[model samples]
Target: MRVLFTSTRGAGHFYPLVPLIDACAARGDDVLVVAPSALEPVLAARKQPYRIGGEPPREAMDAIRARAMSLAPDDGVSVMVAEGFGRLCTAAMLPVVEEVCRDWRPDLVLHETFEFSSVVAAERHGIPHARVAVSAGGFTAQADPLVGPVLDAYGSGIAERLLASPYLTRLPVSMDPSPYDVTHRYHEEPRSAVLPDWWNGAKEPLVHLTLGSEAGALPTAAGLYRGLVEAVGALPVRVLLTTGRHLGPRDLGPQPPHVHVESWVPQEDVLRGASLVVCHGGSGTVYGALAAGVPLVCVPLFADQPANARLVTAAGAGAAVVPANAGGEEPTVLDPDDVRSLGTAVERVLAAPSFRERARALADEMRATPSAAELVGALYG
Candidate 1:
């Protein structure tokens, strides 16, 4: 079958689609991936036909931050979601989505939900379309088991439409590493099992911490860093922290023996060996932990993080503390709003065995998931 996999604009957004793309190709399906202008070469290297365009990364980040700052005292998810809807609908994603659909004329349109580009393309083509959410916004692919309550709770309108679609295939509803049963190249070859770096530091009951790429760049980033450092500084567990390239070791202040902070570390590598993760709940980090059998303590700072954290709590994985724009909101890295408060949350994750148990259970299931190529068989075989 001819398939087009359209992803959102961010590196975090598009990466999840990669495994599925590889799987489909391995299954002998013709696949094309539409991504941001910067990722075209990345896709080509993976052997997928590629095209790229749309807003640059910083532009999108700026938009999100501006909208976030404008939100008044009562503005919350509703405001953010409403604002996001406007930001997402654009001529930018349209050109590529339209062009790919027109040229490929695939049997189906598979897309990452936030990749509003693909969503529009699917609407334009009148082709059978399936949604692959990089996060839990995807109620589309869930089993009949959880569908009823969700539909009943939220109204069946949107969920019903997806469930009713004979052609609408779905990836698994998960916070991290999607449970998309599809075709991929990862399964065809031997995956190099490089565990996340935290393992090298100490032993199990491991604790992983990260503030996300954007969190570390916020004006209040330095204070946030100090808080994170103070929280885990002398803790018994090994801590691997990522500053998101916004700060270097010198800027990060003093470090403890247990904590090793870097601008980047193979996240998946460290998560693979971690027992607990403390993060800002960017879907990438959350899912990375899930894919690796590690539970999370979600410390959401802004944007979709709270929502992402909500999913983590619902999944029996984690909780959120130090809400964005809360009275104690950190204004700059130097703003002191009690960064060490985050440490208590870390302690909770380490002490809570249930969190680890739930993560392990989910990990066990994830490990058994059919690759994207195999998912194709479930639908068409």
Candidate 2:
């Protein structure tokens, strides 16, 4: 079988497809990844076949970023769907994707849930397609009010596109809040934290902080990092901070003796022994913490981070706070006040044991789901 996978140009979007990609390869199926050139290195490292879609126009890129930032704090997630992130991305990659599909004639077009462009292209060419979830639960478009307008804007009865796919599997057990009992679970890959030499002998309570790759790049992210430094600086606990690839020790400013700063580290490794996590509420990070049974202090920046933070709070696994200048139209620079608030949230999670207990409970539920290998067997069984 010929399998083609697609993702929006980011690690979070691309990584979820890895297990499936490997499954296809191991099964002797020809698999190809179609994405922007920026991701070529990532695919190359995996020895995966790939086709670059060049780059989206600067105007389109600017429009996406502007719309994302302009969204009201309360409406960020909904507006993202309503504005059609998937449609816009699909349109941008359509030319190359279509061309590739014509020549490759893949039997399946497997794409990340947010990368809706591949769905459109797959449907147009009569290829069966599947949607893979990047977050804990496959996206819940039906739960959003703007689903109709969003679908219409993208042309055709496109809302069905979300419904048609068999969820690439099902929700993480904790995210499934429905009273109606549902069976069938897809177990995710386990996250094993890599404890570096510095962390190996630490006896103090460890607090891990990360703002994810995208948010950490914002000019304002520096403030949050500094705030985190101050928050844990005087505390007796050890601090492990990852500033993403775009940031360095200098960007984070001065760090107290208790703190350890790195441009990036294996988060799963950190989460393994984390007493608590301080982070921007990206779904991948939130879910990673929960999977490891670690409570969180979610300081959301933008996009789905806020929504994911809320979900973590609603699930009883964490506490969330919005940075003061986070959703503003102008470039946000977190002030001392914002840092104080962040510090306070962190203190609360660390002080409360219920958060830890709740996180453990959710982690148990997550482990109940079928493993990726099991899901692969089910899919091809």
TM-score for each predicted model, relative to the true structure: 0.75, 0.88
Model 2, span 1-381: residue lDDT tens: 898999888887787777778877877888899988778878888877888875667687667677767766556555555554544555677788888788889998888767766766777788887777665442344333455455446567665665556566334555654222223456567657568757457688999988888777676678767777776677778998998877888876776667889987877788888899988887778877887889998887776676778888988888887767778786665577776777777778888899999999888887887776677667754
lDDT of 2: 0.73
Where does model 2 exceed 4 Å of error?
74-84, 135-158, 169-171, 177-184, 191-193
How large an RMSD does model 1 have? 6.6
Worst 10 residues of 1 by lDDT: 183-192
Give the alpha carbon lDDT tens digit for every residue of 137-235 in model 1.
432233323333333332334334443443322212343333344322111121435644534546635576788765666776776767766766667
Provide the RMSD of all predictions against the true structure, rounded to 1 decimal: 6.6, 3.0
Alpha-carbon runs more than 4 Å astray in model 1: 38-45, 56-65, 72-89, 138-192, 195-205, 245-254, 324-338, 367-369
Error of 2 at 221 (Å): 2.0
